[model samples]
Target: MFRPGRLQTAPNVWKRALSNFESRITRHETSSDDKKDLILTILSSTATKREARNYLSKYPLLKENDIYQSHRRILDSDVVSQTSKHDKLINDLLLKHSARSEIQLPEPPQKPEIQLSDTLRVALIRIPTPRRLDPETLRGIALTLRKLVQLGVSPVLVLDGKHQIAAGESRLLTVNDFVHQCDTLIQALQTENLQARTVRGLFEQENFSLPELLVVPLLHGIIPIIFPTTVKKDSTEVVMTPFETLKCLVSNLCGFNEAYRRNNANDLLTVEKIIYLEDLGGIPSLERFQSSHVYINLLQEYDDIISELYIGHLDSSVRDVHVQNLTEMNQLLAIQPAATGLITTPAIATLRHGTRTTNPIIYNILTDRPTISSSLPVNLKKTPQLNTTVIRRGTPLTIHLSDDQPDGKGIDLLEFDRQKVIDLNKLTHLINDSFGKTLDLEHYLNRVNGNIAAIIIAGDYEGGAIVTWESAGGRRVPYLDKFAVLRKLQGIPGIADIVFKSLLLTYSDELLWRSRKNNPVNKWYFDRSTSDYCIPNTCWRLFFSGSRVRTLDDLKGYVDVCSKIEPSFV
Candidate 1:
């Protein structure tokens, strides 16, 4: 691991220096000494530059002018064929600066336009371990990988697991550790998204870079490779080493004949047929840095990798249970793919199939259908028909008022269509079961004004809302005081979706609600909410859908005051 003792200068300062030098270089016919001085000044390390100049002076062919010209030659080369030479020259400069403990790393290649290759199936590349990567450097790496993947290259990143394990040896390897690492990678990839979003959250703004102008050379016909690592041998058993496994995978991916390789031990593989894998520590020397674009492609890839594996957003215990289930299922099926020796989901298979979109599998999951599709690698014993009707149609919502008779002569709660009045006691019974607690019947009736209600069907409330006005920011905001459905109807396809959509359509403009932090349904609430707040020392997270809570102060005040209300469930 190369420990860079001191980090490079700020990006702005580097850009300013480059800008100044470019203007100077174009206008002036400076002397050789003047040009050398400018190079040293731009490098920002006089001592290191002097030593490098002395070293280059040893060769008669390497003039001061030639050294200056080399930098221009590198920046001008527009093809991947010429990158290797430029890479070596830059590495030589970096190594010299490393020795001196002062190096200003070059700015990322400017806006490298990606073009998908017709032939390459996968391009295996390495990235720096998390600690060494700043957001800019990480963005550069992600953009490069995305370009490769866009060009029909399946980028299988080889992270430095050995180093990570060694660094945290005292701490045991757990799912949390893996999750943290994945989150870091995902955050790095989301640099693009972080910049593009309109609202700049406190942390998001500092960690990600905004887009900048750049022009990078087009990458073509470059198949960079590094030797694979070796594993220990067992005396009694024959096992494939890591390198052997890698070679076999390469052979398979490139369609190399195993028989031909077996007959000749020293058979040289063609470049087109071989897969390239690089060490994370060495990738810097091989490629130029990158700048992030506003596109969300890298974030999508990160989501796909984690979600397809079913590891994202899961706690350790849940992940373990899932893995155990998979293990048992795999044993029962007796089917394992050569790639990972595990049963693959349609979502994962879609990624490996080189398809950019996992919409088919996603559509299946969203519609509450099976997580796999007919396109999965393993053939199922029975395959269901593609569901045409994921959503169950429902009658539009209606709000109805109770019979306005004095002295409590009319019903307190009535159906939306006003065809019949709902028995408050029956409504309480159903709500108690749905909420897993006795409904505060008196408080609920009072909040509903003992008259008006929003209901799905008029005869009896299938799903409904009982709301009251709350004065927030000097406005009568409709607070969703209590919402419930019959326990039997819960999770029935489109029951909640249609009911909520209809309710929102009725009161399209401003509403507020607070859900218990522990509620599983909070995810649904959060998704619909335009703005939200999590009050400290409280169980409820208040959410607002409309444009009422415009200021942070108002939002905070509303959430803090509303969350203090006594537990509504009971």
Candidate 2:
């Protein structure tokens, strides 16, 4: 309920009140005595109307509107003038206070004196190839000289054309001269004071030559002028002759080759190395050069490096020396022509596990090979009889309920039997109809088991369901895709595996058996070992048990019975 507009107007009202008060104070200061008395008399009148009229008459120059108008004008004018005066007054007060204060003005900084020492002079004269002297070494010598001076070692210095001493002349000669002059004048004071040391004898030495000298010192005052290499002084670029560049290239290549050999035995030679060796004029082509080779032939001297070097000396030479292209050479090594006789084909394997047996049957189908292998060992009590009837390569294998038992019932009993065969496409449709509409066909197909006798998929059976299938026969197959799918389903909370398992069980039973009398003897049957066969009570628990099934050992015992049934008969 706060009004923003009223809050904003409050500042303007306060500003007007301040301006009016300022105007009134200014009028009180400037008004004549008679005008002031008349105004005061008017204000002291009893009636409000009479007071107003009397006040206006006394200030006759001001109209009824002029009083208010002039008040504002004068206030505004005073504000501008007072602001300027206030700033000036503040500045004057600061200057006056600063003058009275005892704080001293800081002295201007003096340039440092450049005084040379004996050690530095000796070091400079000893250095050979003075122009190529290292900057770091020169700086180090300078620092050593400074330290020696601080230790009170006075030395004489020589100079060039400048009046400034080139060497340590000031410390050794000037200071000593002043001390001697002072000693003569203040002999009485010296008797009771500490004696000043004389550097006269130290400066008189003439044999200052140092052994093994290569650099000559150029003295400028007491300062030593040092000539150092360009690299030490920020800039290092040099224009090299073709021969020099070739030499550097050869040296670098030799180092690289040695490093490569030490690290790896399979180091391949590159064109750059070949060019470097060629420029050294040591070898022609190490091997016979083939014309069809697309890689740059350093021996032929037709590559970019040689071309650029040639063009560099042309009428209009290239400015940038670093420009070089080796893309063609790189491409030659990177690419290869497709080879013939490389066969490509789609191949897949399917595996299925039965109760009791740890091993299962595996079937592989492809353009090159179509076969099935069973892990049931020859020495086992029973084995699955495989249908030897060969089908053409690439033909899809089919499995379904036998036609003798129509209506999709009794299908589970004949599952292991070869009484019926339906293609993968038909089984996919059956699963879709039996499960909820949310079941994805493509996902299910991709999750089909390829490994024999291994859990293919596992998850909550309801919203997030898992279906595990293994290939027939003991064949090694990749089951990661199936496992990934099952993991995805398991991530959904609250969904249990029993829902899907029960649905599959119901579908299998309905599809396998046509009627009660049609139940096959070796067919899968639900024996109520436990009281509750409902999903949550039995099937759910069994599916979610993962590898910890309590009835697994019992299930294995029934494998012999399942094996007795003929492969073709349900």
Candidate 3:
């Protein structure tokens, strides 16, 4: 009854063996499901779609559409709802399994490395785009780069190809590479650093290379040129031709006829007619010449007669006739002052008793002049008289004169801190050194305080030199050499008036004389004295004498005289 390997020989025995085999196969199939579940679990844990897809690929039974649908169902259904009961169970199972073991993943790969060539190393110098860099940062970079070059080190140059700076870079590379025979090749590198918020600052920082200055044609309008088309021997028939030929004739005439041709010759015929008239005693009653064109035509027809008149062969004798006519019309306002029904003011008497300083005289004249009150609109029978009572007492005066030192020794002292005896040549050098670039001292000296009475050039070891003096009106005159300062104080803005008033505050004196006779420091006489003598003591001490006065007290005697003469002097 019991047969081995037979399906039905021993019914119980066959059943047991078949059961064992079936159990093994069932275990193998279940193991595959476990692997699938593991993968699905991993995929579910993923944060992105790609990871989920990779996880699904491990199980051929898993479809993307199925998983996507499941995901949508999970998102739509609530955990407590009957529709999501299966999903909740599956999710719980996956979470339990995932908590049992930890999964290890690989890290992301790093970016590729850049290997620079030896040629590129020598060629590449770091050139930051100035437009993209802050002004201070660019300046610092330039300084550092220059320092590095000075130290014989070359760095890489970074550039933005899309900019006007490309031209400059090309020029620089050409000069540094081909011309110099040095390998200064630039390598292009893509960078976000080249984008700047403000480019104007870069231009103002003076850190970038500039292109050569060139003048390009800027046409505004067409310019017309006229010339003779053809010349006839008989000189009567007119000829017409192309405008170019006329232009050529004009150019030729301009080059050849230096006496008659002008760059702006709009009325050439009029000028010719005037010349002809000048020769023939001018046009008689020019007002009667109704049409300018007719007059010019008549002048052209009688050209020979006009030439004879120009050569002084005419009966009129143009020069004599003009002279006689001018003499006869001398009574006209053109030749003489108009005699109107108004009283003219005579010159006021000059004040005699005062310190007789030339500056005081000029100052007094400027102050005492009559104010024109009737500069108003309206017809009035009576004119305003000059107010003599308004002539306030003259103020004390101070005159400041700014003069360059004789030689550059002072400037040398400023730089080297050494005391050196300076002669005229050395002083000239000093002045040139100080202001040679923007200004010249000799030209500016006579311009400032043109009424300066005296100048003192004091030597100092620490300060190099100090120029101190009182300006007219006793103001402590500050140094004003720069044209900018002069423009602010003396030009259109009216700042000069305020400054002059401030100067008058300290220098006004009533004793200051208003007459040239009372003022001894007149320019003509002082200049003459200075020119005639160079001895330290022979001429005026403040002027010719080279003696050094240590204090303001030394100038007291001169100041007293000026003060006594002009009460306006301070």
Top TM-score hit: 1
Off by over 4 Å in 2: 1-422, 436-438, 452-570
User: Across residues 242-300, which tens digit of lDDT does each residue of candidate 2 receive?
Assistant: 22222332333334334545855632111111111010111111111210111122222
Better of 1 and 2 by TM-score: 1
Report the poorest 10 consecutive residues by lDDT, candidate 1.
208-217
TM-score of 3: 0.14
Per-residue lDDT of model 3, residues 1-570, tens digit only: 645557555778878778866664554444344345434434333434533443233222332212223433333432221212223423443354465333221121121111111110011111223344444444343333322221112222323222332355543342223212111111111121110111011111111111000000000000111111223344332222222222232233223323323543331111000001011222222212210111111211233323433454324554354333222222121111110001111112111222221111111112211222211111222322221111111122222223333431122222221343324344334334333343344444434323232222222110012222334435433321211112111112112222222222222221111123333323322321111222232222222111123245434433333333221111
Instruction: Single out the weakest 10-residue window by summed lDDT for candidate 3.
Output: 211-220
Q: Per-candidate TM vs. native? A: 0.31, 0.12, 0.14
Candidate 1 backbone collisions, by pair? 110-214, 110-215, 110-216, 116-151
List candidate 1 segments past 4 Å from native.
Answer: 1-362, 365-391, 401-419, 423-426, 450-460, 568-570
| 2 against 3, candidate with superior TM-score | 3
Rank the candidate models, highest TM-score first. 1, 3, 2
| lDDT ranking, best first | 1, 3, 2
The global C-alpha lDDT for each of the candidates, from Candidate 1 onward, is: 0.38, 0.24, 0.25
